[model samples]
Target chain A: MAKDNLLGGSLWDAYSNKVTTLMNNPQHQGEITEEEAAAHGNKLIVADFGAESCGDAVRLYWEINPETDVIENAKFKSFGCGTAIASSDVMTELCMGKTVDEAVKITNIDVEKALRDDPDTPAVPPQKMHCSVMAYDVIKKAAGLYKGVDAESFEEDIIVCECARVSLSTLQEVIRLNDLKTIEEITDYTKAGGFCKSCIKPGGHEEREYYLVDILADTRRQMDEEKMAAAADASMTGDFENMTLVQQIKAIDAVIDESVRQFLVMDGGNMEVIDIKNSDDNIDVYIRYLGACNGCASSTTGTLYAIESTLKEKLSQKIRVLPI
Target chain B: MQVYMDNNATTMTDPKVVEAMLPFFSERYGNPNSLHKFGTSVHLPLSKAIDQVYKGINASDGDDIVFTSCATEANNWVLQSVWIDNVLNSDKNHILTTEVEHPSILSTCKFLEEQGMKVTYLPVNDQGIVEAHTVRSFITDKTALVSIMWANNETGMIFPIQEIGEICKEKGVLFHTDGVQAVGKIPVDMQSVHVDFMSMSAHKFHGPKGIGALYIRDSQPLTPLFHGGEQMGGRRSGTLNVPGIIGMGRALELATENIEATMALIRSKRDRLEDALLEMLDDVMVVGERDNRTPNTILISVRGVEGEGMLWDLNNALIGASTGSACASEDLEANTVMLAIGADNELAHTGIRLSLSRFTTDEEVDYVIEAFTAAVKRLRAISSSYAKVGPSPGGEAQACDLLYHHDNDIVVKH
Candidate 1:
């Protein structure tokens, strides 16, 4: 969220479109039945997790093929808030075809990202990051049940700053959530780079999974990629489909040639595009044929196919031509 | 009108203290270090202010009082001076403190440890009381200083400071106490206790803010942490805050006048609030109830309700209180003082400190009791943790437990 959220509603505006959709009606929220497990010839894994601070609990179910280590099916029963339900639903969806080891590597960031419409906006606000964390923890719990190991045994990642007690994931989340571009802002928020001065960069502190400087650079790159992805989506030809009829005709006129107009105007006839309409499989471009071309027979056979093929090749594959 | 009870965090500066400081701000503004009559005029009053501050702390009425910016500064100076003295003397280098001490002591000890000084942070009992014998046992030839607090800022548990001071005197070790909470409200007689160094703050007891003093015994070998031009015979070198020092002197003098009657009145109100809490609220844990505390402080923990949330409700009702310690409450971790007293995380999260001064009255007490009762009801009614077993009805006032658990799912209540 921005400082003032020039957009109204801070928490609501921070949520991505996909999170709002899933939070309203979660698609993959249910318990995996024993019969479904038997039919797939896979073992059932049930994992229950509770957040110690907030008393929110979630039970995740995964049916996996033991030999292939693939999650044949996934479902969840969430006894938490709407954010947790959305995050759990997305986590189960992400685990549907992933192996146990592969699922184990999916962090809370991955779960939050999966629920985001795009990578630019977060699925939930910074405070609700813990719900996604619960989602991530339950995946590890389910995987641990299948592998016959403790979920806590997987916490061997290098912790960066011990003085301020900032871990690697916390710094990454702060960096990603606020779009932090500098190391000093990281210190101002998380106090990681403030203390011991060791974790600011590799030279100051002991070696770790994430140096503060490195997280800033990686997050900045991710932010740039997000901007470019949004730009790429807006600039594609689908942009024409969302335009008004007048704007669409103007867009189609920009692609036509003056020589093509001259070809029609040569025999005391002229064609001018009036409106464009789109249907399921066709785009009907209406034209006002002037100067005797309205009554010419060749206008239908020759000029019709030429305009139709040109529009289909230039704008979209679904385009068609009609003159009225 | 708002009834302020969070004097442990700070106080409403006494009007008298403010009146005394008014002239020094502009009318009598002269650098105490000047040579002219403007500077020399404040010399006698500066001596008088130091004398009053000395009297307030039971020190010999003289210039042994080194004024600092605040209690945290005074604390840091005392500890750092000991460390620096040890560096020069080439003798004992160990310091002993407790786990429940304010961060001014604990964080300084940590910084000293990073510089290769050994610190022993002794734990406290379930009631947040530290026996004097624990400090006695920890003291050795290598121990140069023992820094304890006169009373805890969070729980208001008065430590056995006089007893520990005697033991330190017998062992030939210097004892320094951060007496920020205890100085003005409680009696202090240097003639009785053998405390070698003590720290005091002005604002904790209805004085002005941004001024504090540290008492150093006349003949103790000390090294100043700051080195500058002559100030306090070069013990602490900085330009004197003339107005703040004058206000502190008058505030301490006013706080100590007819002290027994004031203490009695404060004790009644504090005790009455504690009784009302036990009678009007359910699952209340009063920290340090078994131990001797100062008369004006009460620490209570309500089950299934947050300490900060309780404070917000109190603020809404025109009441003032603190949770755990206001200075360190910005961090979301459980209160260290509560945890040191064997409180579990959830219990520690619900700790609120209500401190009173002589300025508090009977009407404020009654209003606070009613406000607190309603706030606990309001918070508990909405708490999810309280949903299973809602608040038990208020029972008759009894000896409240040192700790209480509301449900069986979590048993580490105390």
Candidate 2:
């Protein structure tokens, strides 16, 4: 059925004509037998993959000439929505006549783009993007079956930058060793996040478990802690009471940032130092709670004890913490 | 043969209604609030339209009907105002409703809960029917209002609103029903049922869009949702939509005039389609009982085939249908009615609703039955689960044969 013939109204307008055609009459919707492969001097592989989110599944059939390493024929049977069927059809079409290695390189983007009637318009809606991803997965499954290996083994390393083949450990080491701060700096040094940029953060074309933005932030925080630890060691000798108020505050802030802030932030709470005053014989530190810490009952008891004990151990033994 | 089976979403405006509304838009265009003769001339038709609405619902002359933009506005007005007058001003602070209500009521109840009101969303049974006893059990001393829909838009299961209304009356609590799907499809007599408020949308019946009415029982206290002009006697204040009012008035009149005869024809056609589909397909079940639901609705679930997949096949055949509620179609989530009826996750996604209207013909129904059956067979043959499970006990062997052939064919050769 063509797009103009659809009577379901604007909902059908979301799909391109090519997708609608393939969804209704998929060109490669069938299976290949082992006997057929043997007669042609080829190896047949069948692999099935299912999507847990929508219960959609697809089975890919490939007949590859092992001697030439070229895929002789490709077919697929999809058990999902129309988008999934169209995606699998285009994916199977793209796999034929290519080598086994080349077939594995066909990404979900290629499948989605091939299904589009025009180069600019999307073949399916955004919510249906996962169907093309499912198609891409089944190809890897079929290729893995023929190669006698796990489908996940195709990507042997955690390649953070797929375009440059940069691994996660390589990106982390580069950031730490060279003190790279911004994404532009990382891109300039290694070109890890330069192409595609999906490895930079979330909300991209592909979801990455380890992004360059997070890796850089973690590495920089470790470097800051290392520097703070060195400073603490140098200042630990009995210079607490001899230091001026501003100097003492700065030293306390550094210790608090290293020891207390992370735990407070994890629990959706935080506090800031208001003032430091000398009350009679005791040095008193006044603190105000922010966010969830403001009305918490434990801010008076357990939290107060932790803050007072941390200040006593890190800075001056005579210091007392009070919440106002 | 472009068949439309998504009538619960909206209906086509009757040509008669269009003819009635044409004069108000051009020739008799006047603000009803003005004191001029042109404005005064509009009052006769406006009041006649109001009378038609009152007669359509069998309401007494003492009852009040305020026209709103749509049922969404009418529903919001009742819920929000009840929250202010009963919950905020008085000691009553609890609201009781069902889990399978339209989003207009459920979302408003959720908003009220966030504003410190206690709400209990009563669950429905496996048949998607909420028992009146469940309503009686959930009501407390602090219960302010019991809001529920007269008929579900997805399953078309008519709730026991009459019994539930009596329970609320006995308990001295206010009751409101969202009648967006029930007004013209079923008999709604306000003189018999003891409801304090009811929301109605004209488009759900054959009227034009952008017009609806909220029925308020005589002398019931309600905080005005809008505060401006004295239109609608200060209940809802805006310059009257004269054309929409005229269309709704005439639409409701035609809808109820031969409703029993028209609905009987629609019911027979709906039943023929439903029965034929159930007999032809395997692993298919209707969501609710035929007799308990409205006259023209069938929510069927086909195992091993997705709702969107079936919709695509139907659309390719020039048929228009919906998967579950049309409002939640964009998210592709499982149907809320199915989930509330204790269907598993997969079955929830398989439920498709096909609603009929007065405009539906026997030919359209027959065409849908044939098209839907063919779609099911084709979809099931390609379904991965069907291939694995084979078929249900005593299932049609032809469908299994098709599946077997589809799985074993050597279509692509080296």
Candidate 3:
């Protein structure tokens, strides 16, 4: 079956084997017949949905048992690329035997995950993620028809590619997973820019709400920030010898300025960390008084207690703030 | 069981060209520049290959043809070298070209622009055709070259190269046409057209890939893009791909010899397919059909159906087609040619470019007509947007067009 790939060679290998099989012979991609529905004595629900950006549409057919409110049979027809057909086929398979209530809970990610040949690998590239999403939406559309609700009630994520209906979290996860560097790579993996291409950037075919370039860049920036913050936390909480002078100062200064500075400022008083000293009994932070607190009495009592407690709670429990 | 109609992407290498190339791999395989007879004996065929290219394009002198790896290299050679030396040396670094040229030319223009060369990408009319006068108006003393394609790859629209050439000469500006898609498929009189530089690829004319030729009219002293041993008369240098050159020569000869017969066969089939499709489908655009575009290429845009979905259905029906140029990235972009003509993104996205060759048969053509029609019908049936002509009546033909059938008369439009 692999050898029969009409579009041959390493180029066609981008599509998974399950995807190819389903695309070539979509087993569940036909409308259920009226006679078959009548014989089964089921109430049939048909739902049609079209993506706004790409104009790719799909029709979902469900034959539900009126007595049990269970979807007895499910079928679909997709008006999109091979990925869409394959996705709809799998979405139909996953809908089988689920009660109307249970089937509505199925999501696009669930549809995509079900097509994976292995659990660890992606079922489809990021560009094709929307096909599974479209597949997932059609089910909601059908369920909505059954329950007399709008299809939008089922969607809960911010869609990034309006044309493909690809959401932000899905794009972020894919960029992270595949290490997608460019908008073109994102388009290849997710089909986000495959249609109108407005999602690639602004001033393309049209205006888009969220472009792939911005999403990829924004997500990458957050990832870098998170990584730097994690590295800082690890070193700050380590043993005294392990903390570099810069890290120790940064840790103390951050805690004092952010947590204790406001209380001191209100009284026309302030303190600065002179040095951090570690002995056998306790770790001590040396501070110098400033402003009105230089000769104040409560500065040594409540003020000192407040500063030491805040530093201990934030940086380390063994820490002390000393006024000299 | 498939009708492969995307000939512009690549062709089935002519069997006769392959036959001529067989001996070169075993018996006559030798470097043309070798001192010994084993290699020197290959010189005669090499000379003949160069001669065939010259004769095919009507080059005034055989020496003007310099074979490169492909048209991309040739295009880069003309635009980049001219900009660096001629355009920059004179402090005149502008290049004039149309928006609808092949990417080989357009992408090279982009690279040149990034390198600080002033470029004007002139727009075309609704027919996807660029006029010579439009090019003339853009040219200045700073104009390095007017690089336009003789014919577009996406819509198969042809530019007025001869008229443009006359204008360039009068303005003292050089002209280079990316004739990769036009040569061998059409008659090219280089001298008469007054083109300063021209690029052609062998693969586009049923020859082997990785072999291309550039023609320099009147032997202009343009700088070389390739530099090595004095191969290609020191203009381009590297060891010649002997087998590929021989194959290109043979393919060009065979394609040129029966050019009229090939044109007739291809044009009739193309016209037949285009006419049948236009007659049947109500919302279809035959891009550049009214223009004097290539006879063998037919671009049809079916309203309401996106390009890749139609291609998927066609692939399912065992038919090969394309929406845009093959040299383009794998992403689904609307044809730039269509865009140049001010086509909205919808029409551009719906374009299906089907180019033919002499090898195409009437049976294959007829089969494609049906297969493509059925694909459009199938996609349009499930498409909710393409045919939103309000419930005008529903039947087998109009069901997908006017209404979609359901098991229980539930024509739900969510």
Better of 1 and 2 by DockQ: 2
Worst 10 residues of 3 chain B by lDDT: B390-399
Can you rank all candidates by lDDT, best first? Answer: 2, 3, 1
lDDT of 3 by residue, A1-324 (tens): 376656543323566778877866778867776667779999777776653234356777789998999999987766566677778888889899999888878877787777778888776654456567667767777777777777668768877775566788899999888978888888789877765455777654334568887898998898778756766776846544345556778878887889888888899988888988877667788889999889999989988998888877777787887898
- Summarize candidate 2's per-residue lDDT along B1-414 as a digit string, tens digits: 999999899999999999999999889998999999889999999999999999999988888999999999988998899899998899999998887888899889889988988888877887798889888888999999999999999899999989999999999999999999899998888999999999999999989999999999984778899899978988899999999999998989988888889889889999999999999988888988888999889999888777888888898889888885211254444456776775554556577889999899989988998999999988877766555422112221111100011111212111
Determine which window of 10 residues in candidate 1 chain A has minimal summed lDDT. Answer: A49-58
Off by over 4 Å in 2: A1-11, A33-44, A51-55, A64-71, A98-102, A143-149, A155-324, B325-328, B388-414
Q: Write the per-residue lDDT of candidate 3 for residues B1-414, one digit (tens) a residue.
A: 788889888898998899989999989988887899998999999889878888888788733888899999999899989987887788788888877777778788888888888788777777787777777777888787889999888788888899999999899888899999899998887867889899999999999999998888878798888788988789899988999999999989987877877777788888988899998888888877533877789888787676766776687778887875211224434456765565554555577889888888989888988888888876666554443321111110112121111112211121
In candidate 2, which residue pairs get closer than 3 Å at backbone N, Cα or C atoms, i.e. clash? none
Scored against the true structure, residue A34 in model 3 reaches a CA lDDT of 61
TM-score per model for chain B alone? 0.90, 0.92, 0.91
Candidate 3 docks at the CAPRI level of incorrect
Residue B21 CA displacement from its true place in model 3, Å: 2.5
Q: Which of 2 and 3 is the better model by TM-score? A: 2
